[model samples]
Every structure is written in C-alpha cells, then in structure tokens.
Target: MAAGCFYVSCLALGSLGSICLLFTAYWMHAWRGGFAWDKTLHMFNWHPVLMVAGMVVLYGAASLVYRLPQSWVGPKMPWKVLHAALHLAAFILTVLGLFAVFQYHNQQKIANLYSLHSWLGITTVFLFACQWCLGFSVFLLPWASEWLRALLKPFHVFFGASILSLAMASVISGINEKLIFSLKNSTHQYSTLPSEAVFANCTGMLVVVFGLAVLYILLASPWKRPELGILTDRQPLLHDKE
Candidate 1:
C-alpha cells in the first residue's frame, strides 16, 4: 500500500509540475498570441515548455524504470525497452528545445552560451547524449556480457542521478536568468511578483518539488523494487566486481 502511495504521489507531483510549466508558458507568456522566429517573441516560449516537459518530466519518468512496481511484476525486457525508448524521446525533445533556443538567438542576434545557464545547459545535454549512447549500445543488447554489464551498472546508475541533478540545476538557473532579464520595470521587477514573476517562480518551485519526490522514491530504502522469484536479495546500491 505504501509503495503504491509513493508511486501515486510521484505521478501527482509530476502532473502538478507539468501544469505549472504549461500555465507559465501559455497564460503568463501569452504564447498563443504568435509563434514565429521573426519578432514573435512567443516562439522562444516553446524552448522552456519543451525543455521542462522533456528533460525534467519525461526524463524523470524514465529514471523511475526500476521504481515502478509494475516493472518487477513482469519480464524485465519490456520495462528495459520502455526505459530506453522513453529516454530516447526525452533526448529528442531536448534537442529540439535546444535547437529552438539556438535558432531564436541567431535570429535575434543574442549572444549564445554566454550565460551560466547556457553553459550548464550545454554540458547537461552533452552528458545526457553520452549516457544514452553508452546505455543503448551496452545494456539494451541481448548479448551483453553479464560481467561487463555488472561492472558498468554502478557507474551507469550513478551518472544517471548526477546528470538529472545537473539538468535540474540548469533549469533553475535558466528560470532565474529569464526572470531577471525579462521582468523589467522601474517600479517592480521579479521581487515584486508581477503575474509572470509569480508564475515563473511557482514553475521553478514545482520542478524542484518534482525532482525531490522522484529522487526520494529512487533512493529510499523500502521503496526500492525487490527482485522477483528466486532472487530475494535487495540489489546493492553500487555494483561490486565479483
């Protein structure tokens, strides 16, 4: 019952996070007004929308591959495949989101990768690509040598958690930078909580909440998925060479 509740809470927070991002993008930014690279500033809005949805939310879901109790209830192949596939989709969306930003910057003549957020964002994306490429070529294969998979598994999981943290940090920094740069007024800036500022702050907080919930479930002791059937031992937190 508790595990079920945790899973439910994960989904609940995930939904709330998505709503926060969507509200900021649609209502706060007025994205529907126009979406074009040419002076329709709204086009840049999709960059945040897609990145939040892809890198943060979908990636979070994919990271819960083993945490999903349903995964342990059945053959691991389907769950493994789903994990890789969802990560692939998230990676593609992230690329598109990054491309949108680069295109917008080029069209608007804004300097690229000139901010901390951009630097972190680029590094996170590159790391994600490397992680995916290695995982796809190794673990996803039917004939992976068991010792090799076991040897690399610990690094794989560790790096996965680290990459997610980096992605989250980049997002928070990006949100802060955007609010600071865009929220302009002699009388009131982000501190005063204009409607956009309020929404953006809430959006950032929502993502943070989502990250905590997902990570807690991933790392918590009792919540860890138990092996099925003959393998009754809990998996080691880190793989040890035999």
Candidate 2:
C-alpha cells in the first residue's frame, strides 16, 4: 500500500512538472510574438529535469516490490545493484538540474552552457529509452541466459547515470536562460506578450499528461508472468515429472 501511494505521488509530481513546462513554453511563444521553432525548443528546456524526477520516483516505487522479501519475485543479483544506481543517478540529476534552472542568468557564457546542457539532455533521454527497453526485456525473459542478461544490465545502469548527469546540466542551463531574460528586460515593466501565463500553464499540463501516461504503462505491465513458457509448447512441471 505504501508503494502504491508512492507511485501515485510520483505520477502526480511528474504531471505537475509537465504542466509547468508547457506553461513556460506558451509564455515564450506569446512573448516572442511569433511561432518560432527556436522558441518552442527553448520552452522544452524544462522537460528533462521533470522527466528525470518522475522516472526516479517511479522506479523507486517499483523497487520497493523487489525489496520486500515476502513479495519479492525474480532472480536478484546485479540487477538490484543496477536498479539502485539508476534511481540514485536519476534523483541527483533531477535535483541538480532544477537547481541550475532556477539560478539561470542569461549571458554569453550562460548561452554556451545552455547549448551543452541541451545536448546532454537529449543524450540522457536516449539513454533513458535504452534503459527502459532493456529493463522491460529482462523482466519478460527471466529464463534467458545469464550472460546475455548481464550484457544489457550495464547498458541500462551506465546510461541511466549518464542521463542524470546530463539532466543536471540541462536544468542549470535553463535557469541561466531565465536569468538572462530577466536581465535583458530590466527596463520593461510588464511583458509585451499577451497570455504568457496561459501558455506556461498549457505546456505544464501537457507534461503532466505525458508523465501520467508513462506511469500508467509501467504500472500496467504484466511483470508477474514469465514470458518464456506462456506462449510456448512447454507443459506444466507436474506433467513433465509424469
């Protein structure tokens, strides 16, 4: 029950973060006075941080099931280590990135940082995809050879860590951007862009939706059933004994 509640909370936070990002993007669009791709990209600056946090919490809750002795399922070895590492990395990156974004001040140096941050964020997302795929595959194919399973384990763990580091960079860069924007418009009393708040809200809501979708998929997966014999010609152990 605690795990379930944690999972739900994670989903809620993720959703909220997404909504904030969407809102930020909308504000950028309205302020810029044009539907520019560059502006849209800038708006996406907030996503990596929120995503990292959401993933961290989501995985953390799932780990609880594995940790409990009575409820534990599947072989536990390097997988547990890898899982823990990924979660830790995710948390670190998410927190760092959020800090960086909140502290951002737009300047030439900051701009360069933003560029580097964007690349890192993109890389992190890619790694995250790989990790998720590998994890799901392992869950489904528990009977597979240890060697093959082990090969994918490192990829998941290492990539997850890399993603976290990158997410931290991305957040810092985003904050710098915000700071720069503020400095540049010091003389302005109010934003010229109409509906800036509305846009930000919209973007944030979208992010929430995306996070919820991810959580739903993870929770809905049939991890309890082993895939090997479910669809094969293998008979029950009792029949084989006979």
Q: List all candidate RMSDs to the true structure.
A: 5.2, 11.9
Write one digit per residue (lDDT tens) for candidate 1, span 146-168. Answer: 88988998898888888888878
**Most TM-score-accurate candidate:** 1
Candidate 2 lDDT by residue in tens digits, 1-242: 43454346556655655454555444545554323223243423544334434443334343333323223335554555565565556545554444444344232134433466567655665566566656656744467677877677556545544544444444445444443454455554225432443443345345445444444433443322223334223212212322
lDDT of 2 at 132: 60
Which residue runs does candidate 2 get wrong by more than 4 Å?
34-115, 122-144, 178-242
Cα lDDT, all candidates: 0.76, 0.46
For the record, the alpha-carbon RMSD of candidate 2 to the native fold, in angstroms, is 11.9
Over 4 Å off, model 1: 31-34, 37-40, 185-187, 227-242
